[model samples]
Target chain A: MDERSLPDANLPPFEGGRSLLLGGAAAGAAGLLLTLIGGFIAPKAALYSYLIAFDYWLGLSLGALALVMAHNVAGARWNVVIRRLGETIAAAVPLFIVLFVPLLLGARYVWIWIDPPQELAKETLRLLQYKKPYLNFNFFLARAVIYFVVWSALALLLRAWSVRQDESGEALLTRRQRKLSAPGLVLLILTATFASFDWLMSLQPAWFSTIFGLYVFTGGFVGSLALLCLIVTGLRSGDSALGKIISADHQHNLGKLLLAFVCFWAYMAFSQYMLIWAGNLPDEVTWIVARSRGVWRPVGILILLGHFLVPFFLLLSRDLKRSRQGLAAVAAWMLVIHYIDLYWIVMPASSLDGLGLHWTHLTAFIGVGGASVAAAVFLLRGVRPLPVRDPYLEDSLRYVQP
Target chain B: MKRYVLGEFGEPEDCVEALRKLHEAGVQGLDAYSPYPLHGSDEALELPRSKVPLVALTGGVFGALGGYVMQAWMNGVDFAINVGNRPPHGFWTNIPITFESGVLLSVLSIFFSAIFYFFALPRPYHPVFESEQFRTASLDAFWVSIETEEEEPVADLEEKLRSTGARRVHTVVESA
Candidate 1:
């Protein structure tokens, strides 16, 4: 076979083309407007919804950063073609610093421990008092800033090195990336774990699970992979140049990773549930009881079937992973279910009454998710879709699944 | 009425090219053997995607349902013995076992389906082994074999294989 006949192996650099920039601006504007409207209609619900949306999008960006760092550390070849997408998504960590402001502003409404009701039992008050040092507004805000700063600095450093590698093609940069990623991954995991504890897990104040961070991390990683697949598939269809560079082999590898994370997320969720159920601690069980009862039970079931099983079965096939349309469908499904997973975690904490969807939920999701995606796409538009000058470019282009 | 032509190539790519050309030339019953799987060789052969995944899916579904039902029957109906004061048939408690069973059966199904259905395991011997050069197929050399009716001339086939970079071509007759 003639290798030269194949499309140019390098992706042309994209510089935020006029139409894409306009589209991103439009989406971001629409999302912001919807969120503002939601806040006006239902302040508390909007705050809660914003927290959920913030957690979801932030998880995605952080997860993408972790994946890219891990890939660099491992010197993984399969993800090289898709690595730029991960980097671009990770670059939005800085945007998250700004995005988290609404959550901080509304913290008093969303966090029960921030300001306890006077009628609360003495025991509950004491418990909130005990957690105060870690959960205080100032401390929480400071930690949020630290997490974002650490994450954004690392994201920027890694991305800058990658872009430099694109121009310089220096093999030494790969080594530097690998070396940096070693500590970068550790920092990411530590910060992400504590951040998860501080942000989402503290919503109920009394409820604590050691595995909660892992659960949240897994969900984020899974969502990031799904987003990557969706974007790559969309690019394949929309951009002929990129379509030629990224082949089915890359998609198949991505689908496999997505499936792996799906299983991981399920494992983490089940582990948390089972350990809590077995321990039967009052504080621990309260969280599960809140979600496992009333209308929340069905929602839990949906997460099981929709989030795990449905995608599990659909992605099991080799053909589906290899087919662009099939992989995209599964990616889309996973993305939706990932939001549901986050909603399941965040919403129940706010509305203990039962499973209910407020109009604010939709608005906040659209607002936050749309804007996050827009920002990431805008970042992506500024660079080549693939690292064209990487020493591994040919290796990535010729990658064949074993 | 049975005859075979075997060609050996120094490279996997050459073997794949020969197989593809032969396939495109309307040659019947073509197969390639290599020390390692060659990229795109499967596509050139036009082989159907394996059904092992479907088999595994069916097994997983059955296993999950079976595990769930067994637990539900034994605890909820058969004995009604409750542990931990919780409902015996609660899906939450059963999930761990259900997941284990599903994974176990899916893996087992893939193993059995691939070995028995796809590779046709347990065979003691095959005519492919009759050619001594065929052993190299599992080593460094790549080989392409074609079966044809005895009445058809294989000289043209040998010439075609040579054109595709086959180093050596040989004709073998098999007893019916």
Candidate 2:
């Protein structure tokens, strides 16, 4: 079949990106400043928690972009409607380059392996020193840079390929994407696992769980879904290039993705908790002890409620599944709970001795969240909302979730 | 002789209008194919109900059963490698992988079923390929094809097409 590539007329006006850029910048600055200040006023632990939250939030943003690239390269039909949202989320990858500065600076504060010579048993020091070859500050920065570089390259290639398809009508672009997906998925998993270990789990180096990376995967995957749904809801209201073909099936499929990830996250969280609890190991249990305890207990319970319960129920209804507004609300809640979920997982590492609340928590959240999101929005506003030349643009237009 | 008319479509509405006219003109058994699925084209052509979903569903059910039987046989009876206290059949632990396989199988089943059911893949060299409009169907072209047995010859098809909204009607011999 001669695939005459179709022209795209349905994108947001080029001029509109200006305001989104400005809003993103303003909001990002505000969020980052608030997060920083909140961290500063809090106890030392609160600072670590904020830093952790910042790391995860930024990480998922990058992860989302990576997911988009993969789906594009894979040329999978199911994800066509939401893939643009993922791509836009990915466009925020540069923000993570900047966002990691806090994580890098806080390596000493968060990671036991950082100050190798300080307070460690002979055996522990030996381990830290042995890891020094790969664990040193310089190497960490280099790896971070490499991840960003690889990520940005993939994102650009995927987005470029998609846009070119719009005008070129090369069906082979889809084949190219399919060829790239396996490698892309492998890269995504490796980077995500290492990042989880480095940014979240490494803070308390003594603790280890083989599945730690999968936990992050669960959250990142679900978070991406929530973000995708929310973005699509917003796009449905706006003049994104995809305005023509969005439908109930698309939203329903998004809902199903959201549901699957939600369930996956629960399963992972349960497996992690149950295994440690059953084994009753000191090293592994310390993380859970703080998490499952008194002041922190409510937070854990809240994570269960908001992260699992609310979204599950909200997404359960087929009616809600098909409606953009309903899914959008659920997506927004999921996003907020995602932050809270990260907070519960990471904050308790610091907050275990007692309930640690400080203004720094809010300030840092605002500082980082405000700045990162604003920057993401700013960057997103700079580009056309949808890839106009995507070879699959027409396919995406006709894509129903079913 | 069996009749067919083809037209170029600059806009989606043109295609829709063409479809509605053809349908009303009694162009039964007519089909339209485009580079992408057209919005409102379904109603315009008044095409017969699609069995693709049911075919896909049947494929999924078969896939799920295959997954279950495959995993069960592997872990339960085929090579039941016992590990300490866990049961010989580690069915619980096997569930995730099993689920993934089920999903994977279902997808493959749907894809292949879609191909065979629609006869889209393996590229059939149907007689309809003779029409230039038929060639454009893979690109920007929209067309309505009705065999002589389904409707009267050319004029009847053209009048019906022109009335509802055919941009043009051209005869096509099935591309042998």
Highest-lDDT candidate:
1
Tens digit per residue, CA lDDT, model 2, A1-402: 324344354565234555656665676677666655544554356457667567656666766865665565655665665565576566566666777776676566666677854656787787677667877788877877777777766666766676566557687876776667668777877887787777778666667888988887778778878887787777776755554446566777878889878987888887887677656776678888868878888888898888886777677567787787899999888888887788776766653456555556665665666656665555455355565555555676555432
Docking class for candidate 1: acceptable
Choose the strongest candidate by TM-score: 1
Task: Kindly report which residue stretches of model 1 are placed more than 4 angstroms away from their true locations once superposed.
Answer: A1-6, A26-30, A33-42, A351-363, B1-3, B69-82, B130-132, B148-156, B173-176
What TM-score does candidate 2 reach? 0.66
> What's the TM-score of each model vs. the native?
0.91, 0.66
Question: What range of 10 consecutive residues in model 1 chain A has the weakest lDDT sum?
Answer: A1-10
Per-residue lDDT of candidate 1, residues A25-90 (tens digit): 676678768887778777788888788888888888998999999999888886777788899889
- CAPRI-style docking class of model 2 based on DockQ: incorrect
